[model samples]
Target: MDSNKRRHVGHRRDNTVLPLAAGVAVVAASCLTLFVKALLKRNSKPTQKQGKGREGGSAPKSPGAGAYVRGMREREYVRLIPDVEMLSLQSLLRRIQKARGWQFRDDAARDQAWARVLATAQSAAGGAWPLDFTPNDVTPEQLQALCDAVEAEFLGGLLAEQVRRAGRPRIRVVLGVDPRDPYSWLSGLHEDNTIFVNSNRWREEVSQDNPLVFEGALCRSKLEALAHTLGHELTHAVVLNFFPAMDASSPAYTPDDKHGPVFMWLNRRLFGHVGHASKRLFNT
Candidate 1:
């Protein structure tokens, strides 16, 4: 009996040790990845080339999505929830700061800036904003909640008309992370009427561009980036009439052709330019 008990204890230790070792490996790998990314950013120079797909300016090609359907409801302009005419990241931040008399100082002002983001999110979400220190910590469920709030508050008005005309529910926003592609800002929409937001990419971008911001403050930048990506994908969903898989199979299709002038115009009109869509859109 004592021998059997000893054996059981040994097995428990083995299982515990395995998990601990795996956790260590994961931490070490994450550290290495951050170090390498920092080194690359430090050494790299900004390129002015357009349409070449650079970080912060372009999205990866859509998965399982055929070429863009040309001239298909591209001219249709839908109503927006926000009353503002032009929406840019800077403008959004500025409006919030102005309301509270907050000024951007050096890195020390990060908390003040972050407060504005939370205020805006809480207001827009009607006090249902999920608070987390980092995007890495936020679960997919929390993200979906955020998306639901944004859709309900900012884009809810369009949903009724969309359903009325199309006889189906509005396009659903699904949150997912693609840690493998660290360079992408946002993975383009898929054929499943779901929008994938790269939380991993968002973390990398925030760490690289806003080093001073950390902890909960980091979430401010993440939310802004999320806003941009959500608007872009939502435009695609609406334009495709909430059914991307079917619409994309049309014979007249070309990769990235969905980003033509008409799309940009409609995006601007519907949600305003929040983040860079491509090299052509540039940083807004």
Candidate 2:
């Protein structure tokens, strides 16, 4: 009886010890798993921070785009014109600027300039120029909205007519605002592509005191200063229309200086005027 009781007590002790040992093993395993997970999280923190720092550090390198945005933001003018005339002038300017690889300073200025130019060109082409030339103090968003309206109401019909008149290459006008420089310029990027205008100069040239001036006083009397600029730029485009390969480096091409009579004749025949001939000539 004593031996059996001792045996029973030993069995009970073995069962309790086994279960305690198993519980201790499980606890140890859980602690090790938590420790490993914490270690991995700690190791990953520095890499993530480094990645975020890199992304943040590399954002200010696009100065050109920044300048463009700034110019757009400060734009304060809008002009509207009929579709037929605007599209025709836009098409021609697009051809000229492309051949020269020129860029502009602001979209608002360009659009306004175009509106002026289109009206003048239409008048010159035996159509009536629109009477509304009042400057508007508008935001970039407003200017864009006006552009959308013009595109829908006037540009489409004008573009279609221009295509019919000039043959199937599509004509597009792209306006840009550049804050880094303050000068308006125009470009035609190939006959098929688009016309680009920079309006930096337009804003400065057209103020309350001086108003805009253009091409001797005679043409100035008939066209707004902005319109005259467009005509001159369009002439550049027209010149390219005939001599598509005439580049800045070409011998036939003179600088902005005034060239001699022969050069003037060539220019007038090809480019339609002799305004900068003297300067281009002396420089050449």
Candidate 3:
């Protein structure tokens, strides 16, 4: 009887230990399989072109501009410009005063007041117009023309530089206003994307009574305002190409959210004091 009892106890112990051991082994094997699968997935994925270097990895080398240009072709690209409505000097002054929250007695008085504002603001801002910058004067039937010229001359030059650096892709500019909202303004995608500029804000902020104040500098002149807007939009375009992956991953990507150190670095690199000055002047 004593021997039988000892044998029964031993059998029970073995059964319990064997199942527990088997379960632990199965769990360990499952965990190992999952880890191996994840490792393989990570290794098999293609790497991005730019961020890898900063992330402690190297990119595959390709031929010169030919290869770079070929790679760009796979990406989509577009440019957008909002249309402008030409207003008479009287109409323009009234619109400007309204946008600025300035009270004027009449249209004629507003026009005279705006003229003085423009001259004084331009002198204060300290830059040559039409060369260092271009201004769009609000005149009947000429607003669109001015916008076109700026897009072609100023923005065109900036885009051309980008194309030379990154190689050209399909680019187009969309034009119009957001009917539902009046306070809308220009925006751009840093990579192949569109730029939106608000005509109303441009006119209002560039006015004498209500000059757009940025970084302690005032943008009163039309040219200065245009330059400021162009610089901002161009920065967006450049970053879109240089840091495509950053956009894809970050949830902080928005019109108001600054693109962090990358944007500051590029701005400092490209424009130097002028970029600094513009950033100051526009408060961007």
A best-first ranking of the candidates according to their TM-score comes to 1, 3, 2
Q: Is candidate 1 or 2 superior in TM-score?
A: 1
Candidate 2 lands at a TM-score of 0.32
* Order of candidate numbers by lDDT, starting with the best: 1, 3, 2
Can you tell me which runs of candidate 2 are displaced by over 4 Å? 1-169, 178-193, 205-209, 217-223, 254-274, 277-284
Question: In candidate 3, how many clashes are counted?
Answer: 12
lDDT of 1 at 214: 21
Better of 1 and 2 by lDDT: 1
Error of 3 at 219 (Å): 1.7
- Model 1 clash pairs are none
The TM-scores of all predictions, comma-separated, are 0.43, 0.32, 0.36
What are the per-model C-alpha RMSD values against the true structure? 27.9, 20.9, 19.1
TM-score of model 1 vs. true structure: 0.43
Separately for all candidates shown, the number of backbone clashes (residues 3 or more apart, or on different chains) is: 0, 29, 12
Residues 1-284, candidate 2: write the lDDT tens digits: 99999999999999999999999999999999999999999887756344321111221222123211111111110011122322343455455344323323334434454454444334533234323332233233332333323332222233345455666554344445433332434222344534444443333333334443332222322224433333343344433443344433323233332132223333332223334411211000
| Global lDDT of each candidate | 0.46, 0.37, 0.40
Tens digit per residue, CA lDDT, model 3, 129-240: 2322322443322322333333333233444445557775523333344344445454333344544444545433345655655422356554555544544555556445
Alpha-carbon RMSD, candidate 1? 27.9
Most lDDT-accurate candidate: 1
Q: Which stretches of candidate 1 lie over 4 Å from their true place?
A: 1-133, 160-170, 177-183, 205-220, 242-257, 274-276, 279-284
